[model samples]
Structure formats: structure tokens, C-alpha cells
Target: MAPARPVVPADLLAAVLRRDAAGPLVTHYDDRTGERVELSAATLANWVAKTANLLQDEFDVGPGSRVAVALPVHWQTAAVLLGVWSCGAAVVDTPAEDDGGLDDVDVVLAEQDRVAAVEELGVEELLGLSLHPLGAGMTGYAGAARDFALEVRVHGDHFVPYGPVDPAGPGLLLAGLELSLGGLVDVAGELADRLGVRAGDRVLVDARAAEEAGPVAWLLAPLAAGASLVVCRHPASDQLKRRAEAEGVTATLGLGLDGIRELGRPAPS
Candidate 1:
């Protein structure tokens, strides 16, 4: 019998874990900072588990809770999104600027620099990320917000949701669109097919594309297609070709590199 389709975004991660727990699932790069981080399926799942435990135990996040994520496209952001989905909570992709959409959220997670701005939203449960290469606590941060890096480390490595997650419950919220937990999985599969994300393909995606495409395209779609990701931030255009080659990338998104299979472009000569 065919395996049942994933009911939520977390199921995609579970599928990857079951397939190859030790294989690299998400690889991140920052050219400007000269930082590269790779997370195997098991490692990423552990982070998700810890983050979920922290949210559930500390902030009481659950199926009906709403989380506002005011961060960029990084490996940590992937964990945060998956953690929220695992808990059957809705994630609001809060804008970096102070546009004021977080007033109603139960928790707000923001980068250190953006904590001051997010604090104005009056979210009582606020956490800050340093985005450090080593996942260190926010340096020199003296804000009321809790440190996600420090707090999450003390949580359990395995997560068991307090209750069953409703597949039809709210999952993601963006500027003008909202998707239920089930809808996220459905759209991810559709996007993977539409984008030609073949199974076992190692996909390289630039930060601009990740931001423009959102989580469905940059994160979930690849996972849904059983592909691994090489995410680049502040990508140096001149070095992208070498980086793609080094990463063994079979597909490129938001980058124009010769001999690479770019999205919406003909195969390279």
C-alpha cells in the first residue's frame, strides 16, 4: 500500500528522518560572515524537539496558540517553524519592521536586534535569537526577552505533543495568506512538483529567493520532495558557481549560474 500523505509540515521532517537520519537535510551558508552550518535530519529534528519543548513548557504554546516569528531565512528559523507546527500552533511570519501585526500573538520570537521593535508589540512571551554561528546566547543583550539559545538547551531532546494536533487547525500566516496544518503539506507537495524538485536532488537556494518564496518554497517543498537543501545568505554572486559545485547542488533557485538547472530557466549548456 502507498504510504499515507503527510498531514502537516512536521510529517515532512519525519519522512526525512525515516529515510536518512544521518544525511544532511539542511546546509546553511553566509558568505558575508564566512559561516557554514550543516544539520543532518536527526540533528535538525533534535533542535525542533528542544524548541517545541521550550515553547510548550515555558510559554504554554499548544494547538490554539499563535507564534510570531520575526527572523530571517536561517537554519534556526527552520527549527522554529517546524517546532511550532509540531505543537500544532500557528506561525505568523511577522515582518522585521514594526508594522504591528504581533499584538494578538501568544509568543514572539525575534532576532536580537529586532527585540526592541517586537517588544513594542506588547507580546508578553518574547524570545530572542542571536543567530550566532555556534548557537550561543545573545551577546550583551540586556532586554526583557528570554534567550532562546540558552533556554532551549535545557529542554528534552525528544518531543511528544501534549495532545493530538488537528490537521485542519491553523498552521502558517503570512501577509495575505493563511494555511491550515493540512494545507501546508498539500501546498508543499504541489510546489515541489511545480518547481521540479526531484527526489534526492540537492537544491541550492539564495536568501533573496527564500524570502520571496517563503517557507513553502525554500524549506517545505524540498523536504516534501525528499530533497536536501543548501541555503545561502548574502550570497556572493561571483562565488555562487563555486559554492554550488562544492555543495554538489543539482538544482539552483534565485541564482543564475551557468551549467546549473535554475528554476524557470532552461538547463544550462
Candidate 2:
């Protein structure tokens, strides 16, 4: 029999439930405090669904809408990116360090820490990801920007796609060396199956890949497969190991030779 075709988010998410329905999908590790923060698949899905709904209802994010996510490597980052794609909109991969030429984006989903820098880009609305949920002051607040927490509370976990998306259309947009979309999707499919990544896998990715392979491999690949991803907020030798061990990382999708070496480096004696 021929291999089965991969289902898109709209068709797959509802049927998939293998991941930690109760455990954590994303775990944030703080080297300074040695703290670990977790977000389960169920919870992550809820957030993604709610956030997707808000983006569609409030920002009018749909086909042709480009949203920029300015977040470090973490669970929130993954959720925001997935949420954007779920709405059939393209995700603009903005450098966390710079926000230049973001005028074309209709919505800006940014991190609380980078709000000030993104503000300099002249975006009308900015969504800040907070530690807790807020009930108000999100939708069209202060002209355009809204708090992510507030948006989720008001927006329930129901993601309604504007229409059927063309697989050939732009799924993710990024700036860097150009690569063919067919090649990119093939790589993602290969890696997803090779790593045994499933809806239950809690993957920890090295930022090296996030910059090169684009967010498709780093974010959507596993997400579409029903796996949860945890991106370290910072890159540190010790921190990487702790995150891998603590989060029970099954595999890492590396981008280059240098990243592979760094990921495999031994601990200091």
C-alpha cells in the first residue's frame, strides 16, 4: 500500500490526541533560578486555538495577512507561530533583534521583553505574551495593540479557518538564502518520521535550525505531526543539557554542522 498523505492542521489537530494530554509539551528552563515552566499539548492547543481565534476576529488575520512573531525560542513562540498558520496566514519570521521593514504586516505578535524594540518599527497593534491571562484591555486597545492574555480570555478555543488553503501558497515567509518550498516540505517530512516525532514527542530545538531551515522545520513540522516543541530562551552549554534532560527531549532538528557539534559537546570536567 502507498504511504498516507500528511494532513494539514485543520484536518489533523482534532483527530490527533497522542501527545501528553496531561503532561507538558513545552518546558522553559531558567538557568538563573533553575526553574522549569511547562505547557501541555492540551493546554498548548487550547492557547493556540484561542490565540488563532483572536487573531482572526480582532486583527482580521486570514489569507494574505502577514503576522510577525517576535519571541525567543520557547513554548509561547511555537504557539503563536502555529496559531498564525492555523488561520491560513503566513508567519513573518522577524529577527528578535531587529524589526525593520515590518510595515507590511497587519498584526504583530511580539514578546513582552521585545515590545519596546518592535514599537520602534511603527506597528499599530502589538500583542504582548504575559504570564497570566487578562480579561480586558486587549482588543483594539490603545488604537491597535492588544495583550495576548486578554485576547485569549475573550476568545474561546475555536479556530475557524477562513477557507481551504492551497498547499502551494506561501505557508511561512522568512528572509535569508532562498530555498524551494517543495524541498523544504520534503525535509520536514523526512525529519518528522526519522526522529520518531509524533503528537506525543516533546521536542527541544536548537536555535541554529530556527534561523536557517525557517520556522517550518522548527515550529510547524512537529506541530503538524502533533508533537510539542520547547525552545530554550537562551543558548548556554549547561542550559541545553538541562532542558533536554528535564523536558525528556527525544530528538533535536539541527540546521548545520556547527550546531550538530555544539549539541553533542561533552560537559566540562
Candidate 3:
């Protein structure tokens, strides 16, 4: 019998882990910071497990819980997103500056530098990520928010949800759109097909595009299609071609490369 279709974002990741646990699932590059980090399916899953445990054990995040993520498009953000889904919680993707509807979120996770801004929102539970290339704790931060780098490592590497995750439960909320856990998986599959994401393809996407497209396109679509990702932040225009070649990118999104098959573009005749 064929493998079962994923019903939630976590299910999609579980499928990837089963297929290629040791293969690169996410490769992140930050040109401005001169940072490059790669996470295999298993490695990413480990981080996700730790994050889920932290949310569930520390903040009591579970079904019906909402986590406001005020971070940029980075590898850490990917882990946090999957972690929230694994807990059957909703991810409220909102800008750090915009706190209009975040008053009721159970927890808020933001970059360390944005902690001050998020604090003003009066959120009780706040976690800050240093976004260090080496996953180090936040330096010189004397704030009330907890340090995610320090706390996450102490959690178990394996995660078992406290209760059954309802596929119909809330999963993602962004830009006036809300999707249930199962709906996210369904849409991701549809988007993968629409974007022509092929199995085993290495897709390169710039930060700007990934941010505009959201996780459904930039993260889940590739995973749902059995593809890997190469996410570039602060992409240098002149160096994109060279970087794509070096990464062995088979396709691209929101970038105009000479030979790469850009998604949403017609195939060359």
C-alpha cells in the first residue's frame, strides 16, 4: 500500500524524516552576516522536538494555543513553525511592529533585538532568539524574556505530544488568513504542484520572496513535494548565479537566473 497522505505540517516533516533523515532539508545563507547553516531532516526534527517540548512544558502550549512569531525568514523560524504545528498550536505570523491582534496569544517568540518592541505589547510569556550562526544564547540581553537558545537545549531531543493532534485544529494564521492543520497540508500539496516543485529538486529562494510567499510556499510546499530548500537572506544580486550553481539548485523562486527554472514562469520550449 502507498504511504498515507500527511494531515498536518508535522506529518509532512515526519514523511521527510522517514524518506531521507540524513539528507539536507534546509540550507540557509545570510550574505550580510556571511553565515551558512545546513540542517538535515533528522537535525531539523531534533530542533523541532526541543522547541515543542519547551512550548508544551514551559508555556503550556497545545491545541488552541496561539504563538506569535516575530522573526524573519531563517532556518530557526522554520524549526519554530514546525514545533508549533507539532503541538497542534496555531502560528500567528505577524510583524513585530504590528501588535493589533496579539493581545491573546499564549506565547510570543521574537528575535532578541525585537524583544523590547514586543514587550510593549504586554505579552506575559516571551522567548527571544539570538539567531546566532552557532545557536548560541543571546549576548548582552538583560531583558525579562527567556533565552530560547539556552532553554531549548535542556529539553528532550525527542517529543511526544501530550494529547492527540486534531487535524481540524487551528494551525496557521497570517495576514487575515487562517488554516486548520489539515488544511495547511492540503494547500501545501496544491501549491507544490502549482509551483512545479519536483521531487528531489533543490530549490533556491531569496528571503524577500520567501517572506512574501509565507511558510506555505517557501517551507511546506518544497517539503510536501519531496524537495530540499536553499534559502538565501540578503542575497547579493551579482552573486546569485554563482551561489545557485554552487548549491546545485535545480530551480528558483522570485529570482531571475539565466538557466534556472524559476517557479511561476512558463517552461522554455
Best by TM-score: 3
For 117-192, candidate 3 gives per-residue lDDT tens digits of 8888787799999999889999998879999999999999999999999999999999989999999999999999
Scored by lDDT, the top model is 3
Q: Which pairs of residues collide in model 2? A: 19-200, 125-145, 126-145, 199-226
Per-residue lDDT over 144-173 for candidate 1, one digit per residue giving the tens place of the 0 to 100 score: 999999999999999999999999999999
Off-target runs (Cα >4 Å) in candidate 2 are: 1-4, 9-20, 131-144, 176-187, 193-202, 207-213, 224-230, 235-246, 253-269
RMSD of each candidate relative to the true structure: 1.4, 5.4, 1.0
Q: On TM-score, who's better, 1 or 2? A: 1
Cα lDDT tens digits for candidate 2, 69-148: 77666666666866876787777787765778688888887766667677777888778764332222333224345678
Clashes of each: 0, 4, 0
Give the lDDT of residue 167 in candidate 3: 95
Candidate 3 is scored at a TM of 0.98
Between candidates 1 and 3, the one scoring higher on lDDT is 3
